[model samples]
Target chain A: TQLLEQSPQFLSIQEGENLTVYCNSSSVFSSLQWYRQEPGEGPVLLVTVVTGGEVKKLKRLTFQFGDARKDSSLHITAAQPGDTGLYLCAGASEAAGNKLTFGGGTRVLVKP
Target chain B: EPEVTQTPSHQVTQMGQEVILRCVPISNHLYFYWYRQILGQKVEFLVSFYNNEISEKSEIFDDQFSVERPDGSNFTLKIRSTKLEDSAMYFCASSRDSGLQAFFGQGTRLTVV
Candidate 1:
């Protein structure tokens, strides 16, 4: 089984602060996706990183796929109160039969 | 914008009772998936359906669990006998294909009493 280890299970930051969440795995993946979810709701897809060493920016949120495709990271800059939510990373590998192994998730709270 | 829709936003069932969760994926999407998340836990993939059949399933999807695309637009997950551990938020999702981003429904909170 391909296990994903996430960092800093919980994070509390003041508004305008910056933070990063990491998703690491030893197995290579065809694609990696980042999602954000609020309480009592399903996850909403934030971004999908496919190619190695690729970086995509969605306004204040930046996502990067590692050079080996075994890892990814999400960076939020100048975080705002609206950024508070549970962030998740999912890796999809062909060997895993197109299955998604989600990380434990990071709970972020942006205090204003 | 279109989103996946699930029925019975919340369900409470007695232990050992059968239950079926329903979903209507985005109108044009082709691949369908069922996932569950225990409170405060990560989303777990249950099964994936396409072409009127199942394409993949997780270890959690055992014999007691089955998926059916009943018709042209709806996909359902049937649990023959729900256990207490089955209490969780069940989410239905769909993507144009594996290569696309999957959109998820609001989810059905299943509380087994």
Candidate 2:
């Protein structure tokens, strides 16, 4: 099974702090997606980076895919209480039937 | 701003009972999927459906679990017999095309006792 390992299983930071979450995998993926899920809610897509070394940004959030396509990262600049949530990284492997294999996730708590 | 929608935000059922979780995918989407996240755990993939048939399923998707697109708009996940381990928040998602990012519904929390 393809597995993605996420770093910093738990994080607590004051408002305005910058944070980065990592997702690493041994297997190469055809595409990778990042999602943020709030309590009692389904995850919402943050970004999808398909190309190696690709970078995409949304406001204070930025996502990057590894050059080998075996890893990804999510960086949040100036995190606010609104940014607190469970952040997950998912990969769609070429051999995994386009099915998404998710990482364990990183729970972020941004205190104001 | 179209988004996937799920019904029965929360469900509570006894063990051995059958339960169905419902979702309404985005009107223009053709690919649908189901995933479950136990509290404090990772989200796990259950199944993916397209063209009215299951395209893929994870090991977690045993005979007890099934998915159906009853019509043009609704997608359903049926658990034939609930187990205590089955209690989790089940999410429904859909994509406009394969290999693209999917939009998810709010999720249906299933509690089996």
Candidate 3:
């Protein structure tokens, strides 16, 4: 079984504060996706990193895939109240039939 | 922007009753999946469907759970004899190919009493 453990299960930061969430696993994955889900809604894809050591930016969010493909991170610069949501990292392994293994989400609360 | 759509935003059923959750994936998507997020828990993969058959399933997908693509456009999940543990937010998603970006529906909140 593949598992992705996310750190800082909950984060409370003031507006303009920087935050980073990490997702790590023991198994290598073919791709890693970052999603943000608001209350009572489905997750929205923020970014997908397919190549090892790849980094993608979306506005103020920066997503990076580890060189070994076994870890990933999401960094938020100058977080705002609008950024508050559940941040999730999902890993997809081809050997696992393209099934996604999601990490425990990081519930971020950016207080304005 | 095309998106996955689900029917019945919320469903309330009693334990031991049956329930069917429906979804319409993106028109061009070939891979479909069902995932559930139990209150306060991580999103868990229930099953993955491709080529008109189940490609993968987790332990949570037991005999009581089944999936079907009754038509070319609609995919459904049926839970026979629902349990309280089944109460969760069920999300339907689809991707053009394996390991690709998946578009998700708003989700159906199932409440089994």
TM-score (all chains, Cα) for each model: 0.97, 0.96, 0.97
Chain B TM-score (model 3 vs. true structure): 0.98
Better of 2 and 3 by TM-score: 3
Q: lDDT per model, in order?
A: 0.91, 0.93, 0.95
Ten contiguous residues minimizing lDDT sum, candidate 2 chain A: A92-101
Better lDDT candidate (1, 3) = 3
Estimate, for each residue in A58-98, the C-alpha lDDT of model 1 and write its tens digit.
99999999999999999999999999999999988777767
**Alpha carbon lDDT of residue A62, candidate 3?**
94
lDDT, candidate 3, residue A46? 89
In terms of lDDT, the best-performing candidate is: 3
Clashing pairs in 3: none
Q: In model 1, what are the clashing residue pairs, if there are any?
A: none
Over 4 Å off, model 3: none
Q: In model 2, what is the error at residue B94, expressed in angstroms? A: 0.6
